[model samples]
Target: MPRTPTLSFDRGTLILHPPPRGKSWMDYATWDDRVEKFRIPAIQYRQVVEALQAEGSYFSDEAKAFEPLELSPSMEMEPYPHQSEALAAWKLAGRRGVVVLPTAAGKTYLAQLAMQATPRSTLIVVPTLDLMHQWYAHLTAAFPDVEVGLLGGGSRDRTPILVSTYDSAAIHAEALGNRYALLIFDECHHLPTDFNRVIAEYAIAPYRLGLTATPERTDGKHSDLNLLIGQEIYRKTAADLAGKALAEHEVVQIKVKLSQHERDRYNQLIQTRNDFLREAKISLGSLKGWQLFVQASARSAAGRRAMIAHRQAKEIALGTDGKIRILADLLAEHYPERTLIFTADNATVYRISQEFLIPAITHQTPVKERHEVLTKFREGEYKTLIASHVLNEGVDVPAARIAIILSGTGSAREYIQRLGRVLRKGKDKDKFALMYEVVAEDTSEERTSVRRRGVKRSEERGARSEGKVTQLEILPTKQITYGSGDRTSQRAAESSGKWDDNNSLETEE
Candidate 1:
C-alpha cells in the first residue's frame, strides 16, 4: 500500500509531506527548506483536503487542532425574512463568504444564526472595544450555558466562542490559529489593510464569515476580501430595506458660504498652496501625485510652507463660521428629535460640543465616559450627541432621526456610515430620517462635497439597478448662498430625478 500523506500545522501554515505526486494541489504548495517538505498556506486547508479526498488519497490531518462544536443556542426573537435570506446565501456559499447589509439591518442576528448553524469553535473579531463588549454581551445572553470569552479590552479569557478586537487578534493570531474552526470578521472592510490582513491569513479556520455595511475601500484592497474571507455572497443597501426594515430616509446637502474674513484667509492659503503645486508640477487629484507632493514638501522650506497653507485652507473649509451657525440653527430646529452631529476631526467635535454645549465622544473620550454619553443619548437623557469618526461605524444610536455632517472626507464609506447612524427604524414609521451635509461654498470643500455625494449617487444607481430606490435632494441655503460650486445634483438628476434646491423634498420609491 502506498504511504498515506500526512499534514501538520506549521507557523500559520500547513506542512504537507512527500508532495503528493501527480496531484493538482502542487499549484499552491511550495517546498520549505527548514522542514525539507512542501508547505501550504493554512488558508488553503479546505481546498487541499477536498483535492486529496477527490484523488482517493488518505491523509493524516493534523493541521486543524480545533475540536468540533455542537451548539443550539436559544434565541428570543426570530430572524427576519431578509435576514434569513442573508443567512441562507452565506450557507450556500459553503459556510465561508461575505454578507453586505446596511447598518441597523440585524447583521448581528444573522451572525448569531450562523454560529448556531455551524456550531464550531468560533472567534469573532470586531474593530472597537465597545463592539467587542457588545458582541460579548449578546453572545453570552444568546448562549447562556456556553463558555464565552473576550480577548480584548483588558480581558483575556479564551472560550469556545471568543470575541476579540482586531488589534488583539493581530497580535495573537499565530498562537490562536489552530484553536478555532470558525472566524467571524465584523466590519470586515477593516480586515483588508496591512496589519489587519495578518489576522485573516494567519487563522486556520476553514469556515469564515465577513460582515460589513459598506465594504468599498478607497485603497481598492476591498477586492482582496475574496481571498481573505470569500466572495461577496449577498449584498443589500440601506435603500433596499427602507420603510420595510429601516426608517424612510432622505439625504440633503446644504451649501454655506464662509464669512468675509474666513473667505479671505481661505483664498490666501489656497493661493499659496496652488502656487507650490503649480511650480512642482504635481497634481493633488491622484494618489501618486499627492504622495509626490508630500515627499517634495518634506525636503524644502517652500514645500513646508505650502503644506502649512494646505492645512490652513482645509481647516477654513471644514470649520468655517458659517458651518457653526448653520449647525446651531439646525440643532434648535430639531431639538424635539434625537440628533447626531458628526465632524471629521476631534477639534471640530470639541468645538461643536463646547459651542452647542452638547456631549461629545471622540477617540480621546474615555471608554467609561463614552458609554455614559451613549447611554444618556439612548435613554433620552441627551437628545443630541456629537462625535468625530468614532460613531461612524458600529456604536449604535437607534433613536436618532436627524444627522448633521459638519465635516468629513469624500470617502463613500464614511458618507454611507454617517448616513446609517440615524437610519434605524423608530416608533413613528412616518417620520423621515434626515441627513444634512454642510459644505463650504467655492473652496476645496466644494469639490470634496461633490466627490462625497458622487459616491452616494453611485450607490443610488447600484441600488436602483437592483430594484431599490433612494432619494438625494440638494437644499439651497435658507439665508446665505454664494454659488452652487458643483452642479452635480442638478445634472445627475436631470434625466430621471429632478433637482429641488427649494425646500420641497422628494421621497423616492
Candidate 2:
C-alpha cells in the first residue's frame, strides 16, 4: 500500500496529499472586494524553497534548528481561573472575537492561555517587527515543540504555528490566507485598514482573534472591522485591569509654560501669517492666496528651515525637553527595571535618547538587533528605553514598570497605542505605572484628544447596546488534540511521518 503524505500551504490548510503544485498561488487565491488576494500552489512553494536553499539563505532547510528555550507550564503560565473562564468563553464564541483588556491587564498572557487551551495552526499578527519577534519568542517558549514560523523581519517559514508582522501578512495576504486555521490580530484596532483589511478579506480560515488595549480605530473604520474581520467580543479597561492582574499606576500631567523667546517667535509667525491672510484677501476663502502667503513666508531656504526650527523650538519650549528632564528625574526616583518613554517624532526620540541615558527603539531597527536590545533591556541590563511610535502599540513589555508619553494624541489611534505600552503585567504585586498626555494649554491637539477620547467612551458604552453590534471574531474551535510532547519536537517528529522530509522551511516566491 502506498503511504499518503500531508500537505499544507501558507494559510495552514491540510491535504492528505495535494496534487502536484500548479499555478502561481496568486491568481485565484485572492479575496479582494475589488481585486482579490493571490494564492500560490504547493509546487510553487517547493520550488521557491529549493531555490532559496540553493542560494544558502538564512532561513533555508540547511539552517540548523534553533536551540529550544522551553518554558515550564508551572513557572510562567498559571492562567487565572477568571482568565481561563474567558478562554472558555472565547472557545464558545467559536474562537473568533476580540478581547479588550485594559493596559497591563495581562493580555499577552491571555493570548498564551488561549494558545494552550486551543492549540492549532495559529498566526499572531502584530503591528511592528519588534512585536513580531516578541511574539515569536514567546510563542516558541509556550509551544516549544511546534514548528512555529516567522513571516516578518526578513524571515518566513511554513510551520503550523506562525507569528508575523502586519505589513508582511497584509502585503502577502492572498498568498498566506488559506494556510491558517486560526488568525490572531494583536493591537487589533489597527486592522481593517491599509495594513490589515486585505488580510481579513482574503484568508478564509475559520477562526480569528484580535486583542487590543484600546479597540477604537484611528481611521474611523471600526465598523469595517465589524463587517470584515470579526466583532469586539470582550472588553476590560485599564481602570478594571489595574489591581487585578495588572499594576496600579498613576498618571501625572505636567504642563510647562512656553519659554518667553519661543513665545515671541511663535507670536511673530502667527502675526505675520494673519496679516498676510488679511492683506491677500485670503481670510480662509481664497485657498490659493492663503497657500501663496504661507509659501511666501517659506520663500528663502533659510526662512523655510527657520519655520521648521520654530515649530521644533516651540515644541521644546512647550513640553518635550522639560518632559525629558522630568522623566530623567522620575526614572532616578523610581529606578524602574523596565521603563519606556514615547515621543511623537523620531528627532524627539533621538534627542531624548542622547540627552538621557536611555536606549531608543524604532522601525528602522533590524529585526535581530532589536531583539538583542529588548532582550538586554528585559533582563535588566538597562533600566530605560525611548521609543518613537513603535513601542506604543504591540510589542509585549511585561517588564515595563513605568511608561511616559511625552507627546502626541493627534489621533485616537496614537492615544491608544501610547497608553497600551505599559499594560503588560509583571510578576510581584503587578504594580504598574503610567504617565500620559501633556497638552499645550489650548492647542488644537488638545481639542482632538477630547473628540477621540469621547468617541472611545461612546463606543465602549455601546458595547452593552443591543442595537449597536460589536465584532466577535471566530477562533478555530478544534483544538490540537491527540498531540503529545513539545510542539517543535512534535512537528520535527511529524516530519518523519509526513511526505516531505527536511523541506519544512518556506522560501519567498
Candidate 3:
C-alpha cells in the first residue's frame, strides 16, 4: 500500500511529505535535501490547492489552522457611493486587491463591508499603535458578538479577528502564517518595506484588502504592493470626491521674502554647498543624484562642511522670520475656525508653539499626553495646534477647517496627507476648507512646494491636476462648528449605533 501525501506548516513555509506526484505541486516545491521532502512557501498554499484539485490529486491539507467566522455588523447604515463602488470592484476582482480612497472617505467602513461579504478568520495590519487601538475599538463595536483581539502594543491575544501593528506582525509572521483566512492591510503602502513585506509573503490568506489614501512611495517600492496584496482595483482622489463625501476646499500659496541680513547669510551658506557639488560633479536634481551627494558628503572634511552648509541653507529657507510673520497673519485670519500648523522639523514646531502659545505635538510627546491634547482639540478647547511629522500619518486627528503648511518635504504623499487633515465635513455642509502654503521666496522651499504638489515649477499655478488639487468657487463660510464634537469623538461615543454620514474613522494615514 502506498502512503498518502501530507502537507503541513513549519515556521513560515509549507512542507509536503511523500513527494506528491504532480506537476502542479512540483512547480512550487523544492527538494529539501536534509528533510528528504519538498518545501514550498506558505503564500502559495491557495495556488497549490487549486492546481492539485484541477489535476485530481489527493492530499491532506493540514496546514490551514483558521476557521470560518459568522460575523454581522451590529451597526446599521448605508455605505457612501464611492464605498459601494470600491467594495463592488474588490468583489469583482475575486476579493483580493487594493482600494485607494482619500482619508475620511470611509475606507474603514468599506473594510467592514468586505469582512461581512467574506466572513472568514481575519487579521488586520496597521502602521501604528494608535491605529491598532482605533481598529480594535471600531471592530469590537461593529461586531459585538465576535471576538476581536489585538497582537501589538504588549498584548498578544489570538482571537478570530486580530488587529496588529506592522512591527508586531513582521516579528511574528512565521507563527501567524497559517492562522488567518483573510488579511486586510490598512495604509497598505507601508507593506512594501523590506521588513514588512514578509508579513504578507508568509501569510496563507487567499483574500486580501489594502486601503490607503496615497499608494506611491518615495523609494519606488510601492510597485511591490501589486504582488504582495493585489493590483489597485479601485482608486479615488480627494479632488474626485470633493463637495460630496468631503468638504469643498481651496489651496492658497503665499510667498514671503527673507530680510536683508537673512538673505546674506543664506547666500553664503548656499554658495558653500554649491561649490562642493560643483567640485564633486554631483547634482541634487534626482533621487539618485541626492543619494550620491549623501554618499559623497561622508568621505572628507570638505564633504562634512558641504553637508553643514546644506543643512543651514535649508533651515534658513524653511524657518525665516518672514515666514513666521506670515504665519501670524494667517493664524489671526483663521483664528475663528480650527487650524493645524505643520512644519518640517521639531525645532521649528517648538519655536512656533512657544512663540504663539499654541499646543504642540512631536515624536517626543508621551502617548498619554498626546491623547489628552487631541481630545482637547476635538472638544473645541484648542482652536490651533502645531506639529512636526508625528501627526502626518496614523494619528486620528479631529476635523479642522484650515491647514497652514510652514515647511515640508517634496513628497506628494505627504502633501496629500496634510491636506486630508482638513477635508472632513462637519456640521456646516456649505463650509469650504482652506490650506495655506507659506513658501520662502527665492529659496529651495519654493521648489519643494512645487514638487510636493506633484507638478513642475512652470506648472505650479496651472489648472487642477489629477491627485493634486481641487478648484472650488465657493466662498468660505463663517466659523464651521462641530455640533457636539468632531465626528471621530461622536463615532466613539455612539460606537454601538449607526455612524454619522459626514464622518467615519479618519486616520492621518
Q: Please name the candidate that would achieve the greatest lDDT relative to the true structure.
A: 3
Model 1 C-alpha lDDT per residue in residues 1-509, reported as the tens digit of each score: 76767888876888887666657678779987886889988888888888888887777887887776767676657677788998899889999999988888888888899988888899999998889989988998888888989998788887898999999999987778888888999999999989998887877788999999878777899999999999999988776777877788877667776778887997788678778888998777656766777799999999999888888878888888888878887888888799999988899989888877999999888878988999999999999999989998887888899999988877656777888888877566666798988877666655555455543434544543554444322211121242333334433432332321211111100
Candidate 3: tens digits of C-alpha lDDT, residues 363-482: 999999999999989888999999988777766554688999889887677887888888877566776889888776667765676567666544433333223342221122112112
CA lDDT of every candidate: 0.79, 0.56, 0.81
Better of 1 and 2 by TM-score: 1
Pairs of colliding residues, candidate 3 = none
TM-score of each: 0.88, 0.64, 0.89
Error of 2 at 298 (Å): 10
Mark the 10 consecutive residues where model 3 has the least summed lDDT. 499-508
Off by over 4 Å in 1: 1-3, 18-22, 426-431, 455-509
Candidate 3 global CA lDDT score:
0.81
Q: Per-residue lDDT of 279-346 in model 2, one digit per residue for the tens?
A: 54443222344345456556655445534543544454335344555566667877755777876678
State the number of backbone clashes in model 1.
Answer: 0
Candidate 2: stretches off by over 4 Å: 1-76, 115-119, 273-332, 335-338, 364-369, 430-436, 442-509
Backbone clashes counted, model 3: 0
Between 1 and 3, whose TM-score is larger?
Answer: 3
